[model samples]
Target: MDKTPSSPTAVEVLTNLVADDLKAVNLAIVERMQSPVALIPQLAGHLIAAGGKRLRPMLTLASAQLLNYQGDKHIGLAACVEFIHTATLLHDDVVDESDLRRGQDSANAIWGNKPSVLVGDFLFSRSFELMVQADSLKVMEILSHASSVIAQGEVLQLITANDADTTQEAYLEVIQAKTAQLFAAACHVGGLVAGSTPEEEEALQAYGNNLGIAFQLIDDALDYSAKQAELGKAVGDDFRDGKMTLPVILAVARGDDEEKAFWKRTQEDQEFRDGDLEHALSLLNKHNTLDDTVSRARDYGNQAISVLDIFPDSPAKEALKGIVTFCIERAY
Candidate 1:
């Protein structure tokens, strides 16, 4: 019952920058989503209309500004980052067979899986087109590597699902690949665009890696704690999908014989019966696994902030710090 309020330091100052970039990103999404074919346009439009935080693009823009970037390529690069993320979400919803996203029907659920997938592919292609326009070999290299790593990470997550034997090490690898790598690349490229020194680029990369890890940890924690209405999806969506995240893995490892049996029955069994999800929640709460996960998230957030020390304090630096704080502090 500690309800401490978190401070703003990181991305808060970048509101205007994010706002401006978001307009460009949104416009780019609309233009890229367009198809002469009607079906693809309608389907892509649905997901595009559903509002998301647009954090990846914000990271790209903010990082570039912090390094004193004064060019237009950052705008295109930021848009490309958002497109990449949107493509991943479309594909993920199909894989998860998810019904809800951002309190709206998921693209896969609304448009059916096939069109959702094709639209995702279209977005992927559009993202590349934008990258090519950036005309920076280093930017192209960074995003290409990130896109490939994200796909590989998706496959790794698919492999781990329903496998109760998944270790913390294995789970961390999935997260680093699927989530953190793109975050790292997004910020790293911002530095790249600004022509930052090697050391500074590495520092931004480290900040993003840690920030991405922290972001994912907080997301997993919210799955258990946040209300369905607030989370825009059900509480046990991950468990229902047989997806094993950090909390479940940690809870399973720390749980006793009875708790372990409960997890196996709910998460590993071919068919989960009535009360399975409730029992799993009980085990997680009793063992304090959620709290432990949040603690780890805070630790990573601290590490992310530490990476900012290399940059002199400024509005951009403050915005970067606020982003870290908001990642941990948000209710949904």
Candidate 2:
């Protein structure tokens, strides 16, 4: 929050600011995930312990801090945000037939799909329980609607999967629903619990929505990035899964007939020969689609930062701005 040129990343700054609150959230998560059924806890713990950035929950907590919310309700709500995200990840691994998550064996890969999906459901139920405990119908409405929209987004992505002709508009719709909706709700509820003015809450929601879009855009670009491969994360997972992300969409749009045929055979048909991924990367580079995708992400990141202007300058505001920077700078 202190704008020192040599400060740690925004995420670190925010994490340190919210360290105590985050501890409470983590405790709540561990306590809530417990189940007498061994596998439920076991499988859920596996993913929870995998140590993601916890960014979504962090947004909820930070938004509460920004508004000077005095109550502890944000703690439980932040945990709820995480539960929803973790649930989606579990289901997504199963649906994507993913072997890895966060550079480790996916829950489904280790435990099988049925347990993974069921445990995801368990977490979803727990999330709603937490929401109910918050005792705010507005909060429940926002989060429950986000849950529904996320499911719909997954289905929409499934429909678009393996189809090379997927338009940018459809792709935006998918990310906005699946990713941004929760972000908007997370920030919105934070402001709501603080009794923020409608205008302030709207600003928070808009900020979060744009940040989520930029976050996902960078993630999509990273799937084909050399830096991602170097970081030991799986590159080309999207390509192997035949997922049509922005870079691929742009490449397909710009490609010649032979190139389109190549995409159809690989992405649409799911046929693979050696060097196919490399060739796909080549096409992306040739079209500069990767750079273009990053550019697009930056655009959204800027919008996120701009929306925060409604809030008075404070450490919270500065940290929120840093989050936007962190989201976009990941591409480099």
Candidate 3:
């Protein structure tokens, strides 16, 4: 239960295990992001330096390690995974008109929409270059297909946004495409580099997919959780943006007529007044949707952990299990 910042969480454990590989990935990311244009690196660097957990790239490194991979191929591939993720973040901020990212000014906020979009595209191109360097068509296909799926997921989310009538299945589809696809691909490519058996590769991809879903579900819950604000993270960004996440979806499904109207006004109509967020939080709490959302995430996390049972007991296996715990427990 190492939930506090003072205690190393599961991700930290995995990070420590793959510290050297992570360093190589970081170096590759920095080297690949450079450009004579100056603004490209500057804007991209702003977000890269903002310090995310680098979880996706870590998955790449850890999956390769789990399969006993000994080559440096995973290094460039991990960096490539990161570039795709970073590119999405830049575009996402622009689309969301978000002012802050990772607790600082977003790239779009600082550099404007045009530069953020262009730098995101630059990062994407750099990711493709790394994939080419890998020189494996399977690896290229996995990562490239993930990039496409992620784009489609973002578009799916856009279509579902501001619509209170969005179904839970649709929400799941959105997260699966936008978020889980890359997680699956990251782990899949790690095994590919190791020449893993098809079963092992499938296990890794399933593990990553379940973990990613659990991760995003917890995130959706955290958006309305009081704990988020206490931790200095913005608590109502999803609500304000009218993003139809799991908690909201659950709340809407379980709400009364009056509650439904409130959601429709705030979410569908994008209307807001003082205490609207507070009301939304209260409604979510009243329906117990936030807790239920976390419960659903725990289910996914369990599936993620079970998939790893296919692998023999090893530090890599344990670290991967810890990641599931980290993903689910972060809501606290």
Most accurate candidate by lDDT: 2
Return whichever of 1 and 2 wins on lDDT.
Answer: 2
Please provide, for model 3 over 1-332, each residue's C-alpha lDDT reduced to its tens digit, 9 standing for 90 to 100: 77655877787799999999999999999899999999998888888998788999999999999989999999999999999999999999999998888878888888899999999999999999999999999999999999999999999999999999999999999999989999999999998999889999999999999999999999888888777766456889999999999999999999989999999999999989999999898888888998999999999999999988888898999999998998888898
Worst 10 residues of 3 by lDDT: 224-233
lDDT tens per residue, model 1, 1-332: 99887853444456665677668767877887788988887877777678776788889888998988878788888878887888999999999899998999898877799988988898899899999998988899999999999999999999999888899888889999989998998898888888889999999999999999998988877787756558687898888887889889988999888877877876778478888878778888887888888889889999999989989988788888888888887534
Superposed Cα deviation of residue 47, candidate 1 (Å) = 1.4
Report per-prediction Cα RMSD to one decimal: 3.5, 2.7, 2.5
TM-score of each model, paired residue for residue: 0.94, 0.97, 0.97
* Candidate 3, pairs of clashing residues: none
Model 1 C-alpha lDDT versus the unseen true structure: 0.85
Clashing pairs in 1: 9-321, 9-322, 10-319, 10-320, 10-321, 10-322, 10-323, 11-319, 11-323
Predictions in order: lDDT = 0.85, 0.93, 0.92
Over 4 Å off, model 2: 1-6, 230-232
Badly placed stretches (over 4 Å) of model 3 are 1-7, 230-232
Q: Model 1, 200: alpha-carbon shift in Å?
A: 1.1
Residue 187 in candidate 1, Cα distance off native in Å: 0.9
